[model samples]
Target: MKKYLTQFKPFLVFISTFFAAYIIVTLLYKFYLNTFETNDVDGITNVVGKNVEQLMDLFNCDIKIHKSIANSWLEVWYNKKYLVRIVEGCNAVSVIILFVAFVLAFSGKLKTTLLYIVFGILFIYILNVVRIALLVVLLFYFPQYNHFLHGTFFPLIIYGAVFILWIIWVNKFSKYAK
Candidate 1:
């Protein structure tokens, strides 16, 4: 038993740190969400929606995003067509949380970990905004593949990026890196 425990000590530590960071951050996010009114979108989602709107606008695309009067989401209009709603889940904060947790688990030096987390969060946020914009354009042109685009393709992109980041951290930056 002691031998087994010794062999798996690193794995156990990683799992514990990952879960601890994930749960704590998630709970903090939940508390933040709870502060919003029932029919109001949270600030982060609102910012994400605005960023998407601005991004599309930069390309001269006819894009407009407005807070839905009857719900806690932002309505995205592309080329004057009601295409989708930007919900809290669309903000990518959850993905950032997961990324942070993994980075924490495989942490290197304090300065490196903090810097990586900041940059990683920014990268994910920017990628998410661009993803939403691209998704809007794609959905507008390919309405038939909404499920595949939203449920599978875009998720694969974001999560794949995160996975790549994790691999980079583990191999090149984490304390365990050889």
Candidate 2:
């Protein structure tokens, strides 16, 4: 037991520290938001969806905001259909990648590290918002195949984008499998 602990303590410490920082930061952000009556979209997403909503409105498109049943969160509606969910908030797929990058960097795990996780998170966030906006529009423009677009095509494209970003980061910065 002692030998194992001695061998793995550093790895454990690094993982724990990285996870602690990520969780604390995320929770504190959530706590701060909880103290206010402001909408989640504005507070969280920096109003990207809100801005898009206005653009859609200007086109005489049918998009609106609907209050969520659970979180009181606002959702984007188009032609009375739920267009964007969870308000202006983006999804977390890219965020997890960011976390992995950050923890590895902090722990000195990855090799050839260059661009840190902050940039990765920001890049992914912007891409996610853009993805949502595009998906919403595609739903309206190509109504007949909305399911295929949403369930398969767009996901492949957006996730593919994130994958490419990760690959670039790994090849350029992180020296994995080496």
Candidate 3:
């Protein structure tokens, strides 16, 4: 039993850290939701929606972001036509939480781990915002591929990026690398 436990220690640590971080982040998000009066979308979702709106505007696209009829999403209109909805899940907080948990489970030096987590979360956040914006544009022009783009390609992009970052961290920065 001791020998088996020793061999699986890393895996154990990883699973525990992942679950702990996920639960904590989820609880915090719930607390934030309770504390605020976000009618349609939560603050983070609203921010993502506004950022997507601004990005679309930069392309000279007629973009409008408004409160959705469904109380948990933000309605996005392209050229005055409803194109997409930005929901809380689209904000990428959950993704960031997963990323951070994985990184913490494979942590390196204190300073390096902290800085890397910060940068990783920021990168994921920014990438998600861009992903949402581009998704809207693609959906607008290629409505036929909406399901594939949303359900498959776009998620792959973000998760693929996270996977790459994880590989880089484990190989270069993680204490386990040595």
What C-alpha lDDT do the candidate models reach, one value each? Answer: 0.97, 0.62, 0.88
In the range 26-105, model 3's lDDT, one tens digit per residue, is 89878887876656467888888888888878889888998877477888888888988887889998888888888888
TM-score of every candidate: 0.98, 0.59, 0.92
Ranking by lDDT: 1, 3, 2
- Find the candidate with the highest lDDT and give its number: 1
lDDT of 1 at 155: 99
Please say which candidate is ahead in lDDT: 2 or 3: 3
Worst 10 residues of 2 by lDDT: 105-114
Q: Among all windows of ten consecutive residues in candidate 3, which has the lowest summed lDDT?
A: 33-42
lDDT of candidate model 1 versus the reference: 0.97
Please give, for residues 1-178, the per-residue lDDT of candidate 1 as tens digits: 9999999999999999999999999999999999999999999999999999888889999999999999999999999999999999999999999999999999999999999999999999999999999999999999999999999999999999999999999999999899
Colliding residue pairs in candidate 3: none
Please state the error at residue 49 of candidate 3 in Å. 0.9
**Runs in model 3 with CA error above 4 Å?**
none
